[model samples]
Target: MRLFRPSRRAASLSVVLAATLLATAACSGDDAAGGSGDDVVEVNFGYIPDFNGTSLLAVAQDQGLWEKHGVEVEATSFTNGPLQIQALGTGDLDFGYIGPGAFWLPASGQAKIVAMNTLGQADRVVAQPGIDSIEDLEGKKVAIPEGTSGDMILTLALQDAGMTKDDVEIVPMEPAAIVAALSSGKVDGAGFWYPALATVKKQVPDLVELAENGDFEDTVAFPTAFVAGNDVVADDEEKVDRVLAALRDAIAYRADHMDETIELTAEFNDLPVADVRADAENVQVLDLEEIDGYTQDGTFDTWLSGMQDYFVQSGQLPEAVEPSEFYTGDLFLGAGE
Candidate 1:
């Protein structure tokens, strides 16, 4: 999922409001740690429901990986990445999961990516079967989570099919909301990430899978990372290292126990085990080296450029901001190296 709102006009206004609030909140003291022991560093983690990062958190917590690393993590779910980054900047959260869209904000110097969590999942776009192809979406109400990676992906797919945003009516809604919207005939189609895609398709057996992330880029690689606030990483480097170590262990565990991971993820998400298994099949957990490359080689750079262009053309950003200012990769890969 994405982090920011889709309406450029709304986001611009929000950025101002968020910055003001952040400046004001900075004067207040930190909230009390969730558990005892000064040695215990509290890491507030943000997640969007049904994303791979949510499963990673469940895995890390269930295995006591954080405890082994001498850290205590408090997981929080967010509606999108921009809000996640906002919370990170304000110190409400220390770290969290964000898709490529959120990565743009940091790649442009708005935030930071501490760890690359999941990659290569073919997040799919499902439409009612009769809709058939992208061209069919024109004039139809397409439901998407506004300002997310999914929305951008959908937009790109439409462009590939010789269509543009102007060709279709875009309805902004959450991933969960898409299922009902589609079923009730409120929308002709929707773009969603895993578990929700599975759930929605199951409910609407006639759903058509119009496109996948891989089809757009052909790399089978899209990044969903563990991002930390700049202040949090700088102020508590040791804690950040410990968190990365725990996450690395969790990824290793997930690689070794597919069935167990799937079942646990399903339990944590309260979804059917089969659906979790299907979602897991699409997800490719990354090792540290691969994650590092994503940041270093400008994979994120290209994606951010696309987003910025989309925002600019759509009038989201007041003016183009340098993408480099938003991303920082210096802190990752050290723990598992």
Candidate 2:
């Protein structure tokens, strides 16, 4: 577990470091990862194992929705959003179901957000039996997936609790490892998302959930989106739209077949079906108006702006980012149409 301190961090550094190296890495005249192949699009979509971000896409793939849309989807699992953003920048990944952190890539001219996905209570801070509340996290060793939704939510939760980085010993680790470290008593608490959190609770039935996205003011859930590299968006616009449409279709299918969808998500991630089902409840698939509202009414802007501010204030980002520059409602609108 790696700990992130304010003195040694840059929120947008992942995108910044890889931007120049990967911006044209895909421009070698090679077809994009999701480029047309024999009249079918080849999509290399990256995602984490959590239910919120990967569930619908997995539903799409499992139900053959991608093929129905004349696309072949290759789903790649990543441990965290930052790694997915890295692959996206390198052209190895065409699209990613990523969190607000990856949104920074687009703000820095590294990628594009095709459509908003879920806005739900997917993230939480789980503490050992000894810790009961956010205030209990103070002076404790806390683990979080650095540069991810877990990290962001933890930051906000700390602020809400009237705490700061100095209060807790931050341990940055992969989601799985966070659970491992916590279960083994290496850390007192961890900030992360489900269904991993579900696994932790099973292992430690006495674990306490300190906070989640809903616990914060003016927030319902953490935001996630279908993000694509600029090159993929530039060269194969139709593929992007088709992918978004497939996701929309997947969302509907999940609604119609809730049990089957949950089971599939559980199997895909090797998590308990009950865990998947429970976490699913916290995830809200965005509707047309909600998707459009993200950009039209400053919904997405507000979330991204707050994330940027937190990053800058925490030294994760050097300066503020203009949310409008990296996000768009075009694919979202087209999919709805």
Candidate that scores best on TM-score: 2
- How good is model 1 by TM-score? 0.77
The sequence of per-residue lDDT tens digits that candidate 1 reaches over residues 85-164 is: 88988989888778765555665565677666776465666688688898898899888887667776776688789888
Taking the tens digit of each residue's C-alpha lDDT, what string does model 2 give over 1-337? Answer: 9996543356467657788668567543233433334557788988877777677876876887776666887888888777877788899999987786455556667788777777757778788997888898888899988888788778788888888878999988877788788778889988887767766777788988888777763642467887888888889878788788788788667767878888888888888887788888878766555566666877777777876666777677677767656775756667624
C-alpha TM-score for every candidate: 0.77, 0.80
Candidate 2 lDDT score relative to the true structure: 0.76
Residue 304 alpha-carbon offset, candidate 1, angstroms: 6.5
Model 1 spans with C-alpha error above 4 angstroms: 1-38, 219-221, 292-327
lDDT of each: 0.71, 0.76
